[model samples]
Target: MSFQAYLDNIQAKTGKSPSDFKALAEKMGFTLNGKIKPDVKATQITDWLKAEFDLGHGHAMAVYALLKGKKPD
Candidate 1:
């Protein structure tokens, strides 16, 4: 799936947009101002998403990519 597709699937499943996830991540100290914090590991974010949102690894990684300013080709 494309990057946007992953994001869309996540939103469809979780009822949240990327902005919403960003805000929540900030609250969890995984991110700051829409960017990944220096000390935050991708696994930390993915693990939280898995536990809280039931997202699979791929979808969680999509969120990780977004945090790092990456996009699908």
Candidate 2:
């Protein structure tokens, strides 16, 4: 899946748009355009997804990939 595909998948699976998640992440200091730093980890993203949207590992991975400009293959 492409980055856009991942984002679309996330929305489809969780009923939440990527922009919605982006807002939530920003509130938590996970800026999408911020410098690449080690402060944020995949686990944090996973936890956030699970806690906020009831997303499982697969869905969370899709969200993470979209956030990081990656696309699942």
Candidate 3:
């Protein structure tokens, strides 16, 4: 599937867009100023998304990609 397809499925399943995840991440101190915090590991973020959003590894990684400044395809 395409990258956007993964994002779409995630949104459909979680009822949250990428922007929403960013906001949530900030609230949880996983991110700051619209970027992933220097002290936060990718695994930490992926674990959070997996546990909280019921996302699989790949889907969680997509969110990580976004947090790392990857523009959506």
Candidate 4:
């Protein structure tokens, strides 16, 4: 799937936009100022996504890509 497709599916499943996830990540200290923190590991974010949103590894990685400033192509 395309990057946007992954994000769209995630939103459809979780009722949250990427922006919402970013905000929540910030609150969780996984991110700051809309960016993933330097000290944060991808697994930490992926694990949280899995636990909280029931997202699969690929879907969780999609969110991680977004946090890393990846744009859909």
Candidate 5:
């Protein structure tokens, strides 16, 4: 699936947009000022996404990509 498709599916499943995830990530100290913290690991974010949103590994990675400022490609 395309990156946007993964994000769309996540939103459809979790009722959360990327912006919403960013806010929550900030709250979780995974991010600050709209950027991921340097000390944060991908697994930390992915694990949270998986456990909280019931997302699979690929889907959780999509969110991690978003956090890292990746664009759809």
Candidate 6:
């Protein structure tokens, strides 16, 4: 499935929007400092992405895009 598909599936499963996921991530220990900083490792995001959405890398990134507030095409 495509990235957008993964994100859509996440919403369907959790009934939570990307914004909501972001909030939850913060609660769980994700520091969204903006700009994908060097300190911001992909694994940190990927771990939560995997756990929350049961998605692989590609799909996780799609969800990440949405969390970043970028509408995927």
Whole-model lDDT values for every prediction:
0.89, 0.72, 0.92, 0.94, 0.94, 0.66
Model 5, 1-73: lDDT tens digits are 8999999999999999988998999999999998999999999999999999999999999999999998765
Q: Per-residue lDDT of 1-73 in model 4, one digit per residue for the tens?
A: 8999999999999999989988999999998888888999999999999999999999999999998999866
Ranking by TM-score: 4, 5, 3, 1, 2, 6
| Steric clashes per prediction | 0, 0, 0, 0, 0, 0
Q: What is the lDDT of residue 12 in candidate 4?
A: 100
Give the better candidate number (1 or 3) by lDDT: 3
Output the worst ten-in-a-row residue range by lDDT, candidate 1.
Answer: 64-73
Q: Which consecutive 10 residues in model 4 have the weakest lDDT in total? A: 64-73
For each candidate in turn, the TM-score is 0.91, 0.68, 0.94, 0.95, 0.94, 0.61
Q: Rank the candidates by lDDT, best first.
A: 5, 4, 3, 1, 2, 6
Model 4: CA > 4 A from native: none
Instruction: Give the per-residue lDDT of model 1 (tens digit) for 28-73.
Output: 9888788888988899999999999999999999988887888645
**What is candidate 3's lDDT per residue for 1-73, written digit by digit as tens?**
8888888999999999989988999999998899888989999999999999999999999999887888778
Lowest summed lDDT window (length 10), candidate 6: 29-38
Total clashes in model 5, counting residue pairs 3 or more apart in sequence or in different chains: 0
lDDT of 6 by residue, 25-58 (tens): 5665554533344465667888777886677777
Candidate 3, position 41, lDDT:
98
Q: Model 3 scores what on Cα lDDT?
A: 0.92
**17: Cα error in model 6, Å:** 1.4
Residue ranges of candidate 6 with Cα displaced over 4 Å: 1-4, 32-38
